[model samples]
Structures are given as C-alpha cells and as structure tokens.
Target chain A: MDIDTLSEKIVAGDRRALSRAITLIESSRADHRDQAAQLMERLKGAGRQAIRIGLSGTPGVGKSTFIESFGKMLTGQGLRVAVLAVDPSSARSGGSILGDKTRMEELSRDPNAFIRPSPSQSHLGGVARRTREAVAVCEAAGFDVVLIETVGVGQSETVVAEMSDLFILLIAPAGGDELQGVKRGIMEIADIILINKADGDLKPAATRTCSDYSGALRLLRKRPQDPQGFPKAMMVSALERDGLQKSWEEMTALTEWRKENGHFASRREAQARYWFEQEVRQGLLAKLDTPSAREAMQSFAAKVAEGGITPTVAAQELLQGLRD
Target chain B: MDIDTLSEKIVAGDRRALSRAITLIESSRADHRDQAAQLMERLKGAGRQAIRIGLSGTPGVGKSTFIESFGKMLTGQGLRVAVLAVDPSSARSGGSILGDKTRMEELSRDPNAFIRPSPSQSHLGGVARRTREAVAVCEAAGFDVVLIETVGVGQSETVVAEMSDLFILLIAPAGGDELQGVKRGIMEIADIILINKADGDLKPAATRTCSDYSGALRLLRKRPQDPQGFPKAMMVSALERDGLQKSWEEMTALTEWRKENGHFASRREAQARYWFEQEVRQGLLAKLDTPSAREAMQSFAAKVAEGGITPTVAAQELLQGLRD
Candidate 1:
C-alpha cells in the first residue's frame, strides 16, 4: 500500500480508504506503524474541526439504543456521523457486541453514517490506540461528527476522556439514584450527563436522577475555561428519540463554547504532550521486554524476593544492564 | 551516621533512632537513599511480620479520632502501636498534626504507642515512598501494628493499599449508601470496612450502613484466597472505641488466613515486582528530568503541538535520543 495514495483517498472521503487506514494504524507490524505515521502526516489538517463526542455508560445502560437514535438524529440533520466503539470485554460482552449491530440496524444502514464495532482484541490499550487513530481517520474522511463509544470501565473511560472534546455519560434510571452511577472518577470528567430510558413510568425517576446529578455537580469544581461552569445534565428517552435533538444541540453548544474559550486547543496540545511522555516510557520499556533483559529482570526479581536487594536497587541495576 | 549502627539501634526499639532513620530515608539526596537502602538490608528479616493496617476515608470521616482511640485501645492491651499518617491537607491538619498528639493525649503519653504526623511534602509519591520506609522502621522498632492512614483521594489510597497487609475503609453513616463508596480502585483492595460514628443517636444509621455494605460486598467477587469469601463490615464509634478490639481481631484473623493460604507471601512478592517495574519507569523518567533532555523534549513537544509529528513517533524518537 502506497502511503501517499492511501492518505489522499482518506482525505477524499472514501469510507473504504478510511477503514483501510484504521486497519493499518491498528496493525502491530513495524512497517505498518511507520506507514501509518506517514499517512497521518500527509492527512494533517485535511478535514474541518470535527464535533468529537465521547459516550460511555455501564452495560445495560441502553448505550446501543441511545447511540442508534442519536446517530440517526445527527445524520438526519445532514451531518456525517462516524461511530467507533472501543470494546474492552473478553467475556459476557460478546452478546452486547452483536446486539449493538442488530439494534443499530437502521443507523448502520444509513449512507451518511459509518458505525464500526471494535475489533475482537483483548488488549484495552490496543483498542484505545486504534480508536484514537480511527477518530483522526474519520475526521479526514470528512465526518462532521465523531462519536467514540466506550464502556464505563476505568481504563477505557480515561482513554476516551483524553481524546474527546465533550464526554457524555449515559445512565439507566434505576441504577440506585443518579448519585450511585456517578463516582469520583467519571464524575470529574463528564461534561454532560444523560439519564436514558426516561419515558413511561420511569420519567419521574429520571427527573429525580437528573436533579440529583445536577446537585452533585454543583458541589464539585469545574474546568477553568468552562463559562457555563457546572456540567449540564438532563434526561432523555432514546427509545422515543425524545430529547435527542436537544442533547445534540447541547453538545455542539458546549463544544463551541470550549473551542471559543481556547480549552479545546489547549486540551489537544496537552494531550499530545501527555501521550508523548507515555509513549516514551512505553518505548523504553519495549527494549527491556527483549529476552536478555527479561532474564536479567527475572533474576533481579528473584534477588528482590530473597530480600538481599531493594526494588529500587534492583531496578537501578537492571537499567544499568540495559544501558550497557 | 553509620547505617549499621543506625539499623542496630532501630532494631533495638530505639524510638529516636527509628525517627532519625525515617528522616534519612525521606531525604532526596542520593547519599541518603543509598544509606537508607543499606539500613533496610541490615534490618532484613528483623521484624516478625508486623501487622500493616491501611486506614483511609474522606476528610471529615473522623480518621484522627478513630486512630487515636483505636491506638489507645491496642496500647492498653500491651500491643505497641505505630501510627504513620499521610496527610494531604495544608491547613487545620497542622493543628491535628499536633492535635493528634494532644487529642490522642493518653495514647501519645503511652510508651507502647508511637504517633507521627506526616512530614510536610508536596509530592504524593515522595510521601508514599517515605511512609512505606517509615512503616519498615516502625516494624523494626518492635511495633507489632503499623497503621498507615491516608485520605481517600486517589494516589495515597493506592499507595497505602500496596504496602498494607490488610486495608480498612472507614466511612461515616451518611456518606451515601454502601454502593456509593464501592468504586473500583481502593474499594476492591479493602479487606474490612468500618462505619465510624456508630453510637448513640447515629447507631441505627451505622447499622444500616454496615448491612448495606455487607450486601454490596456479597454482590462483588472476592479474591480466591480470601477464606471469608467477602469483605466484612461493622459499626463503630471512635469516641466510645466500641469495635476497636473486634477490628484488630478481624485484621489478625484475615492476615493469618491469607498467610496460611499463601496470599501474603505472594502479594508481597508481587508488590516487590510491581515496585521494581515502577522504579525502573521512575528511574528512567528521572533521566529525562535532566536539563539537557528536558530542553530537547520541549522542542519535540512543540513539533507535536504543530502536528508535524505524532506523539507515538515523537516519544519513540525521544527514547532513541536518550539511548544514543
């Protein structure tokens, strides 16, 4: 595959090319990583600023239903929508993974919408890395809206937050109050909270959940650049497609506000630096993952377990051996 | 200043020498670190498996009061108690830093109890590292119980959990239901839970909280080696010291069960390797923190921000530069 040709095709809004590019980036082959980098460089600034949205909730939170309706709503507005799900589960989620595709049958069939479930890889980091590169590829493919969906597990939630302009947390009505769903980790990161399944008898519960979440958000500190201050939350019934339009509007408005306030740019810049440092650590460790270093580390670990050497000292020795 | 002499003194239960050894270990100077490592080597296998109890809760959960009363009770039973606090606050904690001395007035006066407030430090890792070493010193000084208390913010709780034989989570009655505190991180690590302030008018609420926690713990899977098969919870009033004896008894029983089942040795061995890997990462990052590398990394970060380089590639390049 010629890197320049692939970049050009992706830039020209070819869905097949975008899919191929994502596949290339996700490849573990060294040559592929090199070509992927080249393709990224070539496609730099080729697309408009995308409305990057991060969606997350626990299993059974009606995430698929919400995304199907939400994606269809956006596509109806004549906007190109790209959905990338970062699936981290190796068990029990097989059903949900397939269920999502069947549930979103209409949206998946839409010409203006592109929906891709995560590949069956057990590594969460691999999924996150691919999802990030895929987000960029979708942008280059001229998708105006990129919705990255991840389960509300710790690792994926963190990855989604780092790569998103807006994070929307979806919750079911009876998950023991909105406060129960809201923990310190995701609570601090979420910009918009949506209490899903808010129709019929559950409407009152949803309203109370929204109010509870709103009250909780008030007590926490907000990002310095957010002019609207506290995170805004409301209830929605994705089954009825009610409140989907308002949620979309709120997301876009919040995004515009963040962009205007320079947070969007600053956050992106900071994320770039953050990933750079992380990769440096990972890249260095990759050297130690070699057979010789592994043996040395094992021996050093044995010595550490025997109590003759401290971990700090053993690590220093291993690093020295690596350096030498 | 000889490390051999210092180690001998600490092993002999010399409080002044133990305090001095801890101060030496906390020092950032290279020579002190070397000496501290030597001291640890000398004190290896000196203490007979001290009971390391990690205690944590949110700020207003009566941590100090609980520790004070609990330490007093243990000392009253002739068990030497050493309290090592990891204080995050810069404010009124200054008074508690002393207030602990005055507030635990009886315990402070007890020859069998040693209470030390945290040394003023901005870096959480530094504090954690020092606290870990301090626990060792306390153990060598013939303290059978080392209670490491940290506030419920993320990092400290994790550090305390890693170094502890058993983790005890202290919570007030009204801090939401039991499900509220049972998030992924520290919650999963805790072996025991105490609903503090469980006396008089608040007794019912504490009992409810305990039952709620017990129900929640049952819903979660336990470690295969946990003979009890679930984390136990109970109500206690620090003022009345009602459950202190039972809490200590539970901790000893759990520790003994884990030791017999091989979880204790395995966990310690695992922690040694965990810290070994972490130290390697930290030691390598320390190399980058140098002036020359910092300047080079800054230029690379600039290029990353300009989108000319991907963070993965930039990090790879940085690691290569360090190697070269």
Candidate 2:
C-alpha cells in the first residue's frame, strides 16, 4: 500500500497497519527508509498524542510482569495501550528481552492492547532511533498510552530518557545496600523509581528499599520540571496487582501538572532537537564505514599502535585525506 | 627554538623547553600545531616512559591535600614527579581546579617535582588532548611519575582514564551510603578506590566505607587485566601522611604485575588507537561548526522542533548537503 493509505489505516487504530508501519521504520533498506519517512510525515497530520512512559530495569526485575498488569489495567479502563521495547543486546544475541509474546499472555490477547518486541538488528543508536519512531507511530494510531521499555544498562537508559515524557526506573528490593546497585547517572535521569516485588516475603524489604531511595532522591538536585514531592520512590507489586492503579494515577497527575506548567510541550520540542543532532552525528560517522575509508583507518591505526606516529598527527592526516 | 633543539632540550630535562613544548601542543594556531607535531615526532625516539596515574574525586574530597602529600612522598623518595590536570569546567568558569599553585606549596617548592595547572580554555576533548601530549613531554623529560587529576563528575573521568595507565578514585568517608555518590561507569574504570581523610575521628567511618566499597567491587564482574584482590578499596589519611607509603607500594605492585603480565605495553597501544579514533571523531564534528553548516543545522532543527519534518529526514538532507 502507499504511504497515504497506510497512515490513514494507522490513524484509524488498525493494529495490522500499525505493525506494518513499525516494521518499515525498523528496516534499513533504502526504499523502506524513504517510505518510512513519508509515512511518518503523513502521520504527523494526525496530531494525536499519548502519555509516553519510558520504563527501565535490570534483568529479572519483573518488567514483563509489571507491564502485563499495568497494560491490562489500562485496557480494562477503556484506554488503548501500546508496548514497545529497545533492547541493545538483541543485536548481538538475536534474542530480544521482549521477544516472547507469551510473557504477557493476558495483555497480548487484549483487543485494546498492542505489543511489539524489540528489533533484533543494528547498533544501539539505530535501535533507539527506530524505537523512538515506532513510539510516534503508536501515538498516531490513537493509543492512549505508549510504554517504551529498555534494559537498565550502559547508555540505553539515557537514550530512552530522551524519547520519554516521564522516565520510571524499576528495581528489585534488596537489603540496606540497595542504592549501591543504582547508577548515579541513571538516578539523575529517572523521574520516578519503583521498588518492584513488593509482595509476599519481600514486603518488608521493598518498603525499606523504597524509603532508602526516597531519601537518596531527596539529596539529588531538584529539576525545574518537577512539582513538589516529585521523582519519589514508590512500592509496587505487579504479581499481586497492587499499587498499579495508584502509580497510574500518579503518572497522570504528573503529566497533567507538566501540561499546565508548559513543560510538557517544551520537553517534546527539546527531545526532537536532541534526536536530530544525534542523527547528524551518526550520519557523519557512517562515512567511515566505506571500504576505502576502513582501509585508511586501519593503516593509520597500525601506525599509531606501533608508536611510529602521534595519534593526533595520524588523525589529522586521515581527516585531510577525507577532505581531499 | 627549532623542533630538533626543543626535543633535545626536553629529553635532556630542560624544564623551560618542556613547558614551551606543552604550550605549543595546547595552541590552536596552525603554525604551532605543525611545530608541536614535529616536536612530538622527534621526541618519540627518546623512548622514556613514566607511570601515568589518573586521579579523580569530587571537590572538597581533599584531592589537593592527597596530591600534595603523595607528591611530597614521591619526590622525597628521589623520584621526579610531574602533575597535570584536565578540568572540563575551565572552559566556562575561566577557573581551573588546579589553578592555584599554592594549593600544593610544599610540592611546588620541591626541586624534584613539577606542577602545572589545567588549560583554562577549550572544550574537554581539546583539554584532554593537550594533557595527553603534555604527558608525553613529561615522559621525555625523564619524570618518573606523572599524575593526572580531574573532577569526579560527568565524562571527564572517562576522558582521563583513556590517557592513563592506572586510574584511582578518591572519596571522602560518608556514613554507609558512600557508593550512592559514585557513578557506576567511573567505578568500572577505576583501578583502585581510596578512602581519604582517614585521620582524626573520621578514621572509623573511613574503614567502614572502605569495607562497603570492597563488597561492592567484589560483586562487579572481574576484569581480565586484574589479578586476585584487584580493584580493591583502601583507607588513607592524607592529612596525617598515613598510609601514603602503603598505597604507593600497592600502586607499584599492581604496576609491576601488569608489566610482567604484558598488560602494560598492550594497554598503552590500545590507548594510542583510542585517542586516534577520538581525534578523527572530533575532526568530523568540527565540520559542523562552520557558519553555513551552523545555519543549515539551525534550520533543520527548527523544522524538527516544530514538527514540520522528522528528525531522521532532516538529518539525511543535512548530510546529503554536506556530501554535495
């Protein structure tokens, strides 16, 4: 189908059309890239918006469980929910974190819910870019909520934060040293931290972990975008279906506050500009991937490794060659 | 002076010529850059090497005090020491972390020691590049040890780590939550963690912090370059000059083991290649700084922000323009 028909179908909340559009966005072929760009441009006229929540957690942090419960809750409340993931490791492992649709059986079967696994090709930057684009596609498809999930490791969290409206970090309850496992950079970007597994035997531990993180968050520099008592830690039990409603309420409250304070629109604008610069940087780096450029870089790298030429001098010569 | 004379003077331990060579390296002038490259090429034949130690800590962590005591100890042991700093904030504040020479009064007065402040202008990349070159000049000048210091925040630690053989992170003793302040990325790169200010009533707290960090480090994946009990934390009292000798011994022990295991030579080769790639990346980014390129980027960015064009499409157009 042409871009117009596909975009129209997507805006009408057709799941099959939305899936096809996302696949086009993930494809690296030249023709598909052109079509994807055209489709996105067409969809821009939809002017539909969703509450985009970025969620991240380490492996075994019960991310799938929480998403299943929370997504089901939204669908039951007459809201269409879409789930997308950005898995950096999928490029190497050929297995995505959300690859198993059975992991969220109930939500996957829900008519009002849409679930898509991560793309299992390309570098982290490309993966993130495609995921961000997929999010826009979901929003244009009349989804009331878009949940973008990523593993809590390396630079992935930062990339997810750039595309998200409110970033939530999920962590398993540990002993008194729970804060040690949290990265300082990740903590700085998180708008809310959820202590998962707050049911059964882990109840006391989760409460303690929640309080510890609350104190730690208090020590962080306050962001201008947040209202009072924001970016706080909360306890949640996805298994028991507890705290999901309260957490959703808090998310909507924060989103509404930001919308009233004018931070919501400005944040999206800044994120667009950030992604634009990132694309430019990636495009420039892609130039070095040609056979001749690779040969030149390898030869210069050998010289640098042997200490025969200073790194700066070798780089200058290589860049000069590119210019010529 | 000519490049030949400058290299010879630097090799022969002429401090003034060494200083002049570093100034040339730091200069942005075309002529000075050419001279600096030539001088570096000439000095490569000197074949002298020094232990390059990168130290980082937050401000008020007694970095100056620790360095003063450590430098005094090294100089007193008859080893010539050179101190260089990389301060990213200097570009904006016009003040450097190591700007005050009197901060290390005793070390500055020592005949066996050399102290230099951070370059007060340029971005972090340029500052790191010049500092790396200055390290080479110091090595040619027969310094037995070179200490590189940077603030313990942001990406500066990673930059300094790229140019140094050993990375040490210093922290002040805090009550039980010390690890919360440390960035996980920095912790992974650190070869050693030092708990400073272990004197007076804080001695007990320092020991507790050291133990806590030791447990945390043990949980991290073991690196192949390290031997048993490696990347461990230690307690030091820079105020009372306590643990200085023991820490020095540990550093030498680690260095000697790495040299024997062949990690020393390989690490430097890898660092040289890393720096070469960094320079190439920086050179590519510099193309975007031109007037016409700036205008193009702003126009594209504005379109992206206003939803007139997708970021990917705008970036592709901008890159195509560059190619044309």
Candidate 3:
C-alpha cells in the first residue's frame, strides 16, 4: 500500500495501520525515512486528540504497576489509550522484555487499550526519534491518551519529557534514599510527582516522603519548560488502585490549563524547533563522514589521544576538510 | 607581541604572560582564536608537570574553604598552586565575584599561589574551552598543582571532569537532602567523594554519610574513564586543617596508578575526541548563522513557531539551504 493510503488508514483509526506507520518511522533505510516523512506530511492536516503524558521513574519504581492501574482507569472512562515504553536498556540488551504488555495483563485485556514494546534495536537518540513519531501515530489513531513510559535514568528521561504535554515523575514511599540519588534535572522538569505504594504499612512513610518532596520542590527554582502548577507532590497506590482516578483528573486538568494559556501549542512548536536544530547537526555530521574526512578525524583523534596535538587544532583541520 | 613570543614568555614561567595567554584563549574574536591555537601548537613539546584536579560541589559545600585549606597544605610542601574556576552562574549573573580569591584570603596571600577567577563573559561551553587552555598555561608556568573549581551544578561539572586527571565530588555531612538531589551522571564520574566539614559535631554524621555514599558507590558500574582504585569515599576537616594529608595522598596515588596503566592517556584522548565532535557542531552552527543562511533559518523558525510547518520540515528546508 502507498504511504497516503497508510496515512488514511491510520487517521481512520486503524490500529494495524498505526502500528505499521510506527514501524516505518523506526526503519533506518533512506527510502523509509522519506516515506515516513511524507506520511507525516500527509497526516499534517489531521488533528491530534490524545493527552500526551510522559510517565517516568527509576527502574523498580513500580512503573509497570502504575501504568496497569492508570491505563485501566482511563479506559474505564470510555477512552481509548496507548502505552509506549522508551527502553534504552532493551536496546542494549537486545530484548524488549522488561515492560512488554504481558506484565500488564489487565490493561492488555482491555479492548480500549493498546501497548507496544519499545524498539530494541537502536541507540537512545534513534529510539527517541521513533518514540516521538509513534506518539504522533497514536494521537492520529484516535487514542484519547498516550502514556510514554521511560525509565528515569540518563538521557531517556529528557527525551520523553520533550514529547509530552505533562510529565509525571513516579516514586515510592520511604524512598528518601533513592530520592537523594535522583538525577539533577529530573525534579526541575517534573510536572507531578507521585509517591506510590501509599497504603497499609507504608502509609506514614508515603506521607512523610510526600512532605519531604514538597519541601524540596519548594526550594527549586521553577524551570521555564515545566507546566506552571508543576513540581507538586501527591500520593497513590497502584496495587490498591486508589488515587489513580485523581491522578488522571489532575493530568487532564493540567493539559486543559496549558492549552487555555497557549503553552500547549507553543511547547510543541519549541520541541519542533529543538529537533530541527538537532537534525541540522546530524546532517552536518553526516557530510563530514566522507572517506577523507573520516581519515582526518581518525588521525587527529590518535594524535590528540597521544597528546601530540590538541583537539582544538584537529577540529580546525577537519572543519577545513568539510569546506573542501 | 607575536604568538611565538607570547608562547616563549608563558613557557618561561612568566605569570603576566600566563594570565594574558589565558585571556587570549577566552577571546571570542576569530583572529585571537587562531593565534591561541598557533601558540598552543608552538608549545606542544614543552611538556606538562601539573597534576590537574577537578573539584566540584554545590554552593554551600564549602568549596572555597576547602580549597583554601587544601592550597595552603600543598603550598606548605613547597608546591606552587594555581586555582582556576568554571562558574556558569557567575557568567550568567555578570559577576565572577563568587569564587574570586577574596573569598579565600589565605590562598590569595600565599606567594606561591596563583588564582584566576572564571571568565565572566562566556557560556559554559566557551568557558570550558578557555579553562582547558588555562590549565595548559598554568602547567607551562610551572604550577605543580592546578585545581579546576566549578560549581557542582549543571553541565559545567561534566566539562570540568573531562579536562582533569582526577575528579573529586565534595559535599558536607548529613547531606542526604542534598544527595537526593545530586545531578545525574556526577556520582558515576567522581574519582573521589569527600564529605568536608568533618570537624566538631559533624564528624559522626560525616562518617555515616561517607558510609552511605560508599554503599551507593559499590552499586554503580565503574566507568572506564575513572582512575583505577577510585570512587573512594573520605572525610576531611578543611576548616580544622585535618584529613587534608590523606585526601591529597589518595588523589596523587590514583593519578600515579592511572598513568602507569595508560588509562590517563586514553581518557585524555577520549576527551579530545569528544571535544572535537563538539567543535564540529559549533562550527556548523556558526556557518548557519551566516547572513543568507541566517535569513532562511529565521524564516523557518518563524514558520515552526507559528505552526505553519512542523519543525522537522522546517529543519529540512533550512538544512537544504545550507547545502545549496
């Protein structure tokens, strides 16, 4: 089938077409990239309805459990939902087994839900590019909400945050030890922080953890990219299935407020601009990978490694070759 | 003066020429950049003697206090010391006042010590460039120990780490609240973790924090760039002038071990490669800012911001213009 036909099928809410479109975006072949770009251009006129939410936390932070409960609650509201994981480890390990839908049996069984494992073959940058496009496909396929699940470690968190309207940073009770280890920029980018497992014997610890985060959040300088009401802390229990309802409501409310303030559209535009800059860099790099340029870079790299020459001088030489 | 004369003066251990050489590196003018590069080329075989160390922590971590005491001890051993800072906050705020020598009165007065505040004029990347050159200058000028002091916050920490032979992450005692908020990638990069302010009542808490960090360090995958026998934790009383000996001993031992195993040379080569890649990107951005290309980029940016086109498409258009 032609890409236009594929675009039409995806816009008409065809899950099979949506999945295929995502696969096209994930392909590294030159022809496939052109086709994917053309298909996106074709779908450009289509409106997006999904509330794109980025959900993240350190591994073993009950991410799968939270998504299971959260997806179920959203689907119960007569909403179609899609869950997409961004797993860099899967790429490294060549196995997308970690957050695959079999673990979320309840959500997997729901007719209104769709879950796709992360692409396990590419580097982090490529995975991010594919995940962002998959998000667009899900939004076009009539899903009311798309939850991008990414581990809160390293570069993955930043990538997921950029693709979402509201970012939810999830944690657990008595996690002060782990919290001390939270990456520097994660809290600043977080829209809402939820203390999970806030039930039974963990209740007091959860409340204390919430208070601690709240205090810490207060001290943070509000980052310009964060939704204004962000850095706020709340409590929830994925197992008890409590607080999931309020969490959904809050997520939607924040989205609505951002749209009303024009931040939603502007945020998307800014993201587009950022990716555009990145593309420019990548293109320049590709141009510099010609045989001669490669040899120059390699020679300079060795000289620099051996301390025979400075990197600045080598850069000057390779940059000259790019001009030639 | 000619670049060769300037290089000759710097190599002859002239402090005036050393400071001016640093200023030359920090210059943004294209001609000065060329001159500085040429001067570095001229000094390639002069050899380096200084043990370069990167020291970083949050603002309240008593960095200046620690450095002052540490500098005194080194100077007491008849070693000439040079302190160079990478202060992004100072850059943004238009003041290098924060880490200037006045904050370390004893070090400022030490006849054998040389201190230069961070260049208040450039972004972190530019500052880092100047700083790496400044380290070279200080080394040529016969400083036995060159300390690169940067705030423990943001990208500056990572940049400072790459340019040095060893990186020390410093913090105060009972800093769980602060630890929970450490910038990601930092703990993994640190060669040594020191809990300063270990004198008086803070001693026990310092020991506990040290143990906590040690346990955490044990869980981290040791980075290949780290010096062998590192990621070690220690306690220091910079104020009481105690524990300084052990800390210095460990740092020198790690440097010696790394040099013996050739990791030191390999790490510097990797850093050179990393910076070479960065310079390519910067050079490409500069090209994009040329008059015709700038106009195209602006038009595309406006279109992207107004939602007239997706950023990827806009990027494609602008990049096409660059190639043309």
Candidate 4:
C-alpha cells in the first residue's frame, strides 16, 4: 500500500495499518525508509496526541505483569491503549523482552489494546528512533495512552525518557543494598518509582522500599517540570491488581498539573527538538559508514594505537581525506 | 616559536615552551589549530610517558588541599608534576575553580610542580579536548606525572576518566546519605574512592564512610581490567598529609599490574581511538555552526515544536537541504 492509504487507515484506527507502518519504520531498507518518511509526513496532519508513559524495570521486576494490569485498567475505562517495547539487547539475546504476547495474554486479547514487541535486530539508537516513530503512528491511530517499555539497564532508560512525557521506574522490594543497584542516571530521569510485588509476604518489604526511594528521590535535584512533592514512590501489586487505580490517579494528577502549568506543551516541544537534533547527529555519523570509510578508519585506528600519530592529528588527516 | 623549535623545547622540559604549546592547542583560531596540529605531530616523536591520574570531587571535598599535599610529596620524591584542570562551568561562573593559584599556593611556587587552571571560556567538549592535548604536551616535556582535576559534578568526571590511566573519586566523611550523593556512573568509572578528612574529630566518620563505600564497591560489577580487591575505598587526611603515600602506592601498584598484564597499553590505545572518533564527530557537528545552518535548524525546530511536522520528518528535510 502507498503512504496515503496506509496513513488514512491508521488515522481510522485500523490496527493492521498501524502495525504495518511500524514495521516500515523499523525497516533498514532504503526504499522502506523513504516510504516510512512519507507515511509519517502524511500522518502529521492527524495531529492526534496520547499520554506517553515510558516504563522501565529490570528483568523479573514484573514489568509485563504490571503493564498488563495497568493497561487493562485503562482499557476498562473505555480508553484505547498501545504498548511499544524498546529492547536493544534483543539483537544480541535472540529473544525480545515482549516478543511473547502470552506474557500479557489478557491485554493482548482486549479489543481496546494493542501490543508490539521491540524490533529485534537494531542498535539502541536505531531502535529508539523507530520506537518514537511507532509512538507517533499509535497516536495517529487514536490511542488514548502509549506505554513505552524499556529494560532498565544502561543508556536505554535515558533514550526512552526522551520520547516519553512521563517516565516511571519499576523495582522489586528490597533493602538499601538493592537501591545501590539502581543507576543514578535512571533515577534522575524517573518521574515516579513504583515498588512492584506489594502483595502477600512482600507487602512490608515493598512499603519500606517505597519509602526508601521516596527519600532518595527527594535528594535528587528538583526538575522544573515537576510540582511539589512529585517524583514520589508508590507500592503496587500487579498480581493482586492492587494500587493500580491509585497509581493511575497519581499519573493523571501529575499530567493535569503539568498541563495546567504549561509544562506539558513545553516538555513535548523540548522532546521534539531533542529528537530532531539526535537525528541530525546520527545522520552526520552515518556519513562514515561506507566500506571505504570503514577501511580508512581501521587504518587510522591502528596507527593511533601504535603511537605513530596523535589522535587529533590522525582524525584531521582522515577528515581531510574525506573532504578531498 | 616554530613547530620544530617548540617541540624541541618541550622535549627538553622548557616550562615556557610547554605552556606556549598548551596555549596553542587551546586556541580556537584557524591558524593556531593548524600550528597546534603540527606541534603535536612533532612531539609524538618524544615518546615520553607520564602517569596520567584523573581526580574529581564535589566542592568542599578538599580537592585543592589534597592536590597541594600530593603534588608536594611527588616533587619531594624528585618527580616533576603537571596539574591541569577541566572546569566546564567556568564559562558561566566567571571564575575557574583552579583560577586562583592561591588554592594550591605551595605547589604553585614549587619549582618542580606546574599548575594550570581551566580555559574558562569553552564548552565541556572543547575544554576536555584542550586539557587532553595539554596532558600530551606535559608528557612530552618529561613530567613524571600529570594530574587532571575536575569538579565532581555533571559529565566532567567521565570526560576526565577517558583521558586518564586511573580515575580517583574524592569524597567527604559522611554517612549513607552522603554515599547516595555520589553519582553511580562516576562510581562505576572510579578506580579508587578516597574519603578525605580522616583526621581530628572526623577520623571515625571518615573510616566508616570508607568502609561503606568499600561495601558499595563490592556490589558493583567486576571490571575485567581490575585485579581482585581493586577499585577499593580508603581514608585520607590531606591536612595531616596522612594516607597520601598509601594512595600513591596503590596507584603505582595498579598501574604496574595493568602495564604487566597488557591492560595499560590496550587502555591507552582504546583512549586514542576514542579521542579520534570524538574529534571526527565534533568536526562533523562543526558544519552546523554556520549562521545559515543555525537559522535553518531554528526554523525546523520551530516546526517540530509546533506539531506541524514530525521530528523525524523535520530532521530528514533539514538533512536533505544540507545535502542539496
């Protein structure tokens, strides 16, 4: 199908068209890139927006369970929900985190819900870029909420946070030592810290962990976008379906406050500008991806390692060669 | 003043020539850059080596005090020392952290010690690049050790760590809350953690803080380059000049082990390649610094912020315009 038809179908809330558009965006083929660009351009006129909540947690932190419960709650309230995962490690692990729909079986079967796994064969930057585009496609398809999930490791959280309006970090119940395991950078970006598995024997532990993180978050530098007493921690039990409503309320309250304070629109504008600059930087780096350029870089790297030339001088020579 | 003469003078340990070479490297002028490149190329033949140690700590963490005592000890042992500071905030703060040599007055007056403050007018990347080149000049000038100090805030620590053989993190004596204040990313890169002020009333507190960090360090993932029990935390009192020798001993032992195990050369090679790639990336980005390019970026950013175009589409349009 052409760009116009695909975009029209997407705007009409056709699930298959949205999926196809996402697949096109994830494609590395030259022609597919052109089509994806045109499709995105066509969808721009839709001007649909969604509550983008970026969620991240370590493996076994109950992300799938939490998303299923939380997403179901949104759908039950007569809202359309879309889930997109950004798993950079899937390229090396041979298994995407959300590749198995059974992990969120109930939500998968819900008519109001759509779930998409990560593209399993791209670098982190490419995956993030594609996921951001997929989010746009979802919004154009009239989704009320777009949940972006990423593994809470390395730089992926920062990348996910950039495309998201609100970033939620999920963690298991543990002591202060476990708190040390959390990346400081991730903590700085998170708007909320949710202690999952707050049911049965884990309730007290989860509560304590929640309070610990609340204290930790208080110590972090305050962001201008957040109102007073924000970036707080809450306890949730995905299995028991407890605290989901409260968490949702907190999210909505934060969203409403941001919207009222002008932060909502300004935050989106900043995110858009950030992505634009990122794309430009990536495009510039792409210039060095050719076979000859690779060969030249390899040769120069060897000389630099051998101490035959200073790194700056070697880079200047290579850049000069490129110019010539 | 010529490249050949400057290189000769630097190699002979002429302090004025070394200072002049660093000034040239730090210069943003087109002609100065060319001359700096030639001078660097000439100095590559000097083949001298220095122990490049990068140290960082928050303000009031006794960095100046520690460096003064440490530099004096090194000079007393008949080793020439060069100290370079990288302070990205100096541009806006109107005062470089090390601009006041009185902070290290004794070291400043010591004939065997050389101290240079931050450039005070460049971005982090430019400051880092210049400081790195200055390190090379110091090495060529027969300095036995080059110490790079950066304020332990923001991204400067990572930049300094990239150019150093070992990274040391300095902190004040405090409890677990203070531990939380340390950036996790900086902790991951640190080779040693020193809890300063281990004298007088703070002795016990300093010792406890050291043990706390020691436990924390154990929980971090083991690095392949480190031997067992490495990346440890220790207590130091810069005022009393205690623990300085032990810290130096550990640094030398780590450096020796790395050299014997081949990590030393490999790390430097990796650093050289890193710098070369950074220079290439920065050179590519410099293309957008033109007035017309800036205006174009502004217009596209406005469109992206306005929701009139997708960020990816706007970036593509701008990139296409560049190509045309």
DockQ of each: 0.54, 0.75, 0.52, 0.77
Full ranking by DockQ: 4, 2, 1, 3
- Candidates' C-alpha lDDT: 0.79, 0.90, 0.82, 0.90
Q: Across residues A40-159, which tens digit of lDDT does each residue of candidate 2 receive?
A: 888888999999999999989899999999999999999999999988888888888663589999999999999999988768888888899999999999999999998866788888
Off by over 4 Å in 1: A90-103, A119-123, A175-178, A199-219, A222-230, A306-309, B88-105, B119-122, B173-184, B199-215, B225-230, B306-309
Number of clashing residue pairs in every model?
Answer: 0, 0, 3, 0
- Fnat of every candidate, listed in order: 0.67, 0.81, 0.62, 0.78
Worst 10 residues of 3 chain A by lDDT: A175-184
Give the runs in model 4 whose Cα sits over 4 Å from its true position. Answer: none
Lowest lDDT block of 10, candidate 1 chain A = A90-99
lDDT (10s digit) by residue, model 3, range B1-324: 898888888888887888889888888889999999988777766886688899998878789999999999999999999999988887777888555878899999988899999887656777887888888888887899999998865688898988888899998898654456555578878889999989899998999898888877888887764665568889999889889999999988888888888888777778878877777667756767578876877778777666577655666777777777
Candidate number achieving the greatest lDDT relative to the actual structure: 2
Over A53-101, each residue of candidate 1 has an lDDT whose tens digit, in order, gives: 8899988889989989999988898999998877777333542262266
Model with the higher TM-score, candidate 3 or 4: 4
CAPRI-style docking class of model 2 based on DockQ: medium
Please, what are the lDDT tens digits per residue for candidate 1 over residues B205-239? 88888888887777667678588655888888898
Task: Give the number of the best model, judged by DockQ.
Answer: 4
RMSD of every prediction: 3.6, 2.0, 3.6, 1.7
RMSD of candidate 2 to true structure, Å: 2.0
Candidate 3 A-chain TM-score: 0.92
